[model samples]
Target: MRTSGRRIVFLVGLQGVAWLLPAGTIIQQEEREPGTSKVKAQATISIDAGKLRMEQEKPGEGKSVMIFDQSKQVVWMIEPAKNSYMELTAAQVQQMGGQMQQAMKQMEAELANMPPEQRKMVEQMMKQRMPAPQAEKEVTVREKGQGEKVGPYTCIHYEVLTSGKLTREVWTAPMDQTHLGGAEFKTFQALGEFFGKLSGQAPKGTWELSGMNQMQGFPVRVLEYEGPRATSEWMLVKAEQRSLDASLFTLPAGLKKSSMEGMSRE
Candidate 1:
């Protein structure tokens, strides 16, 4: 769950390179429930080129890792507990979404032609299969001025509201923590853009990280809420830029890889 700080000195040499941080740049986030303030999960993220790897650690449960490679246009979910890994390409994910839409349309047409009694049975069946309509979503990110310090970084506050309810409250701090700047920081901005594209995108209403561009720094602390109660808080704990082996970005050896369906099997 921890990225070695010992390797960080090597990353300093990567300044002004095409890749902003070194390959092993590790960013850690820890989550804790609101009222109880109990730790729930810990996540470590490493990014290089078009590849992003997230390793999540839970107290009792086994570890899980997810890799999203923009160059390959694919996502992989890995469960070390089961020794299994699954892959989903961008095309495949979009195709699955398309199939669901087609099925819905076909069901609507059939219902339109059915008799009253038959329609009622079909409607009941549809209700069981179809998900309920989601509430109309509204996403807005508003700056809330200065925020309290988190660790060594001073933060700026911002609120992400959904349908007029507060969803995420963020404390952002400047990238100076990385000791990267000038041309290197500019390269990092470009890298962020590429990462955004690989991670699907923000829909019209979903505010998922929508206001990042407006902020001057990375979000160091994020508090998520369920209605008025705080669900959990995520904050950046440690960041280390270090040399990394390219092999880490690719699939680890001795693991079976398949589509999502295979995820449950292995």
Candidate 2:
């Protein structure tokens, strides 16, 4: 229960901001996380001044979409497989996150009052039930040098070290060159600031890209490896500026719109 609650808080905060830009479509190549598979997935991220959407491409799979509307301060997770969309407001998300944190604090208080052995058993049971966490990764990023083409443009290279071991190389080109600048960039910044407060922790890449405001450019390619094995890579395949139809920012017809608050109340 605690884990799921934490996940909700994290997801609500992250989804509200992470993927965004101007009126354009960005095609990205996403490989499964390390140890999963060699197969890759294509994702289309579309953004306009007022909204953002991400759709993963897969054969024989029903359409799934995550849409965020900045003006409304809401997010919609659409599942065509189920013919439904789940929505959450910024206020509701923050309130739910606060509830989760308070519940955890109360749990800690109860744990403190319990006998040592009982507390240990409870923790052990929790560990056994939950999935193992990913390797503890402390990411340190620095601009190192230059690199070859990333997508359509030449880029500068940056290295990512996880727990002091170099594990990733990133290539970046100018943000404007990606066709996402001015108003859209400002929208992302606003979302970042808004969510950073609710999440209590800044997103990982957010910290790594801190000074990019003055430096320019965003990561266009990221190659991640584990030792000699190539774990994963996500690269920007295409980007262009255009006016996205407003309908694309909303749920499709015949699908029901639902809210987290209503479900929780029920």
Candidate 3:
């Protein structure tokens, strides 16, 4: 689904704030193993008013390309822009996963120590600060199709019912070429059940689905369902699996250092 420009700005701001926190403070974390890559894949997303098309390719080490189209015009492109030495090994990815698990446990312990009223207040604050839900509840899976000859893998298709009752479908294949027919079916069923509970309404908390994609290249996930308010269709665009150049993950260069100094003064 194509997101409106306003929604893009809002999400970018939200992500910026999220990145300000230490990695250990993240609510959810997934480790991407090094050297994992997907050859190619396509995703067609539909929502209330529009649809988005995505094509991705990982051609070499530390390089990948993502092309997004909405309403038949190329809207966005993601390419390798810079380089850094912060690459991770497979073992390190596993360790990071463990660290994330431990961090979540610690956070739960701390939250448990809070008084009842304080915890309630905290929950309320979190809900109030939450972003708009990306996927509308009207979304439905109409028909699913699969293929077996795609590199020792199979593709799972999901039919999405838009708010206007229009049906659109998307096909996903594993980046690692692993057959995920059973798992994909289960995931779709579970997602449908969860959406059914909302009664075509948005909720008041973030909903996310993260894991590997069809090609087994890199970890991919969805962070569109944010709360009761529906997000723009554009937010549903799928990202590809590939090594993200370290520079893209870091703060941009050439900004005046005085901004930090001024914040300290305040």
Candidate 4:
């Protein structure tokens, strides 16, 4: 399975806009077992970004393309396919960029129109909702504890309270590779309400793992996020360490350059 560079770009955009919650924290644990590094698997991802949706298909052969959609219907497609490039006219790229700038300006105007007290409340609530870091505590090996299954994996459960008034309980499962799954991580309901008030949504909230997984003999890491209104899954399907073709990332020479230098000044 090859990774999609476009997905990485989208995830970076999402993280840039996501407001940090006071109760948010990341936990990772890995198991070093022999032959684990030898196993590899492929994965498909479905991402929903409010107005736009994208589907990624990763297989053993050929390059991957991301199908774009709007309201459940296909609208456009972008692919960093092998040998062949997805051609985009320079005018189209500039038009898309201009529309994005306009949409951002509109969203900023909406936020700016919010009442002063409401804005303060939103900020305070976000601060309180962010995940708190775990204290200087060591994991003690316990004789036994409760066990549960999340999805197809079994997880060990643990609970903690942060300095803020938020509590969290997490269930983690160890996979063969460094990839760890937080099958069951619960956060405060108030956090959801707080985000809702601020016009933010995290359907699954921010809980997932990032690390290496092999796709079609290539070592790649999958970074995924699921929230109430949006879900994004990304994989570094191909990396330099795996002998990926350098030409795969280059733009096509056949693309014509645009002559619109004076248009923006007007």
**Clash count list over all predictions:** 0, 0, 20, 19
Instruction: Find the 10 residues in a row with the least total lDDT in model 4.
Output: 210-219
Highest TM-score: give the candidate number. Answer: 1
Model 2 Cα lDDT, one tens digit per residue, 1-266: 99999999999888776455234545344545545544456667777675677776555564567677788887677766667778767787677667756865787788899899999997788546531222233557777777567557778888766667777767778777778776666655655544542443322232133334444476676677777666777667677877577888876778777664432110
Per residue, candidate 1 scores C-alpha lDDT tens digits across 29-79 of 788776455788888777555566778887987688877666677667788
Winning candidate number (lDDT): 1
How does model 3 fare in lDDT? 0.33
Return whichever of 2 and 4 wins on TM-score.
Answer: 2
Between candidates 1 and 3, the lDDT winner: 1
Worst 10 residues of 3 by lDDT: 23-32
Residue 52 lDDT in candidate 3 = 19
Off by over 4 Å in 1: 1-24, 35-37, 100-136, 178-208, 264-266
For candidate 1, give the lDDT.
0.66
What are the Cα lDDT values of the candidates? 0.66, 0.63, 0.33, 0.31
Assess candidate 2 and give its TM-score to the true structure: 0.64
> lDDT order of candidates, best first?
1, 2, 3, 4
